[model samples]
Every structure is written in structure tokens, then in C-alpha cells.
Target: MPLHKVININSSTTIFLWKITESFEDLFDEVQLKDINLIRLNTMKSELHQRGFLSVRKLLSHCGYTDFDLIYDQSGKPYLEDGKHISISHSHEFSTIVLSDQNIGIDLELVKEKVLRIAPRFMDISHLDNLSEQDQMKKATIIWGIKEAVFKLKNEVGISFTDHIFEDPFLLSDKKGTAKLRFNEGVEQFTIVFEEIENYMLVCALKDE
Candidate 1:
């Protein structure tokens, strides 16, 4: 994977993702953030490969001309002081950020067989038992991608998957699906399209009237 991209799938909305496929070493060399941002290696979530991710974020903050300290709401939503709506996602070898005027959420996942084992809990039986031979790993990733996006948009801890699931037409076997989301009587709720890049899946959720 090479880190050289800023593909704009939808330019009108400024909904684009910066994907860096190179090693974190390359990312470190490309962007400098070691000065203002400190990695609290002593105390932080284990999920982070270490405090290295914070530095990556600091690099993004620098690009956005933002000062660092982002606070997380009880719902686990990360907030930026500037009013620029944003969403970010990173996987084993990829990192992405989605920018928009409206509230936005993003998710990235490395396709794996484990996703199939866990689909039943979040997905209805229709998602599982109904798949034809046409439904392949790539196809299943589409549903997971959209659902992941919705989860980011909602950002509420207790929001049940059953209540928040999309009800529009789902994609047939081996195809990607799109839908306009309606979540918890909210304002300007939306469901953006999902796209595949490299070996990862990306979902973008936005709120714009």
C-alpha cells in the first residue's frame, strides 16, 4: 500500500477521504506534529497502536489549522473546536478523514471472515440466511460498511441496531447499496453512499439539509 491519495468521490459536498497506505513511518515523515502534540504513552486506550494515532490526528489538526485538545462526549463522539464537520477512520494500513459542512461519520474495516460470524447480532436473518451464491465477502462488506456509517452518525451508546437500521431497498447479492437514513427523529439526517478502496471498506454518514 502506498500513501498517495486524496480521491474526491463527491466534490460538491467536500466529502473526500485522505488515504495513506504507506507505513506509519512514511506518514510520520510526510507530516510533522511532534512539537505541539504529545503522546501520553503512559495513559491511553489500548486500542490505539499506541499514542502514535494521536500524533496522526495532530497532523490532521495541523492541516486544518486547529489547536489540539479534542474532547469526547459521553456518547464517545470526538469533537473539534472549529465547526468543521468531520469523520475519521483508520485500519491496519490505511487512515482516512471525511470533511463536510454537515455532521459526518466514517468507518473503515479490513474485510475478514470474522465479520460473517458476527453479522447475525447486528444484521437481521435476511442479512445472513438470505444471501445467495452471488453474495460474496465483498458484497457482505457493503452492508457492514453502511451499518458502520450509521453507527458513527448516531454516535449514541444505547441506540439499538434494530431501531436504527436502514429500511430502504438493500443491494442484491454482489452489489453495493445506498440509502437515505432516518435516525431517532433527528435533524437533517442522511445516508451517504459507500465505496470500496484498495482492500478496505469506507462508509460516510452526513447531516446536511
Candidate 2:
């Protein structure tokens, strides 16, 4: 599929989403992968994961970048050669990338009832009260994405989503919220914005400045 959407979060930040509808062979033939990445792709055990990985390269190409322009740190966080901060995420059929002058993280997740079942393990369950079953799942997914995004932004060791991250109360109608990470003997706040795309929830997080 072509580019699904582009979200300009601010003058300096943007999000690009791609809905994967092509075959692995097609995507594989289209992208120019670095040698190491080519080996990595061939070693992937799942075809779905391989497709997701290539779809991200497609998105990079859309943004005037290639696999050669991307690199990962020892912590596994991705970086662009041009000095722009970037975050990448993909779930099922959707993949997304966020670019900003400041550090940022983005998450794309499929909405599933399983999140509600395990909410207590990672988030405050009370926030799900008084909401319908569907909204409960949606909210839990958003909160999970928030934690993942913050973790990606920090890229630090010893951060536990259940123990160190907390989300403030926010209604589903708000489409945005705030969270905090109490780690490394200090507390840092983050601003998050989320939207529903098809059956997935896409969330982007950045440190509060």
C-alpha cells in the first residue's frame, strides 16, 4: 500500500504511517538494504516480521532515506545519519515512523481485549472504571503504547513499565494525555498524543519541554 497518512505534530515533528498490503517478495525487491540488514532480514524466522521490517525501509524511502542512512545503537534504538531524531514502530499490517528535531518515540498497536485482561500488570486499572468494555480496551492499549514510547525515548536500562511509568487520567475523547517516568532517581514527564487508525492505536511521545 501507499503511504497511509502523514501527521505533522508540530513545525518540527512529523509522523508517517504505512499500511502494508504488498507481498514480501515485492517489498523485498523494491528496497535497497544494507549488507548487514540484508543478512538480518534473511535470518528473520517470520514472514510477517520480514515484511514489517521492509515496510519501514519503504517509509524511509518515502522520506528520502534508505537503509544505508539508518543505524542502531547498542541499546537497539534507531538513528538517522542526518542528525534528526526518529522512532519506528510496526504492528500487524501497519508501520509508522516519527521524525523530530527533538528526541521522540512512537508506538503502533492493535487494539485487543487481552490488554484489558492484563491491565493491572502495567497500569492503574481504576482509570478503566466507568467506561464500556470497548473503551476500556482502547484506553489500556493507549496507556501501554505510552509506556513503550517513553521507554523508547529514554532508551535506558532498568526502566520497567509496570514499576516506573504512570499515566494521568484522561478521557478517550481527549485523544491526548501526559505520563511520567520515575526512574534513575529522578522523574521526567512526557506528552503523548494518540489516534485510532482502523483497528490500531497510534501514539507518539516526547519529553515535556
Collision pairs in model 2: none
For candidate 1, lDDT tens digit of each residue in 6-88? Answer: 54545533443444444545544444343423354334455344323533464365446443445456766766666666666
Model 2 segments more than 4 A misplaced: none
Q: How close is candidate 2 to the true structure, as a TM-score?
A: 0.99
Stretch of 10 with least lDDT, candidate 1: 34-43
lDDT for each residue of candidate 2 in 1-209, tens digit (9 for 90 to 100): 89999999989999999999999999999999999999999999999899999999999999999999999999999999999999999999999999999999999999998998899899989999999999999999999999999999999999999999889999989989999999888999999999999999999998998
What is candidate 1's local distance difference test score?
Answer: 0.56
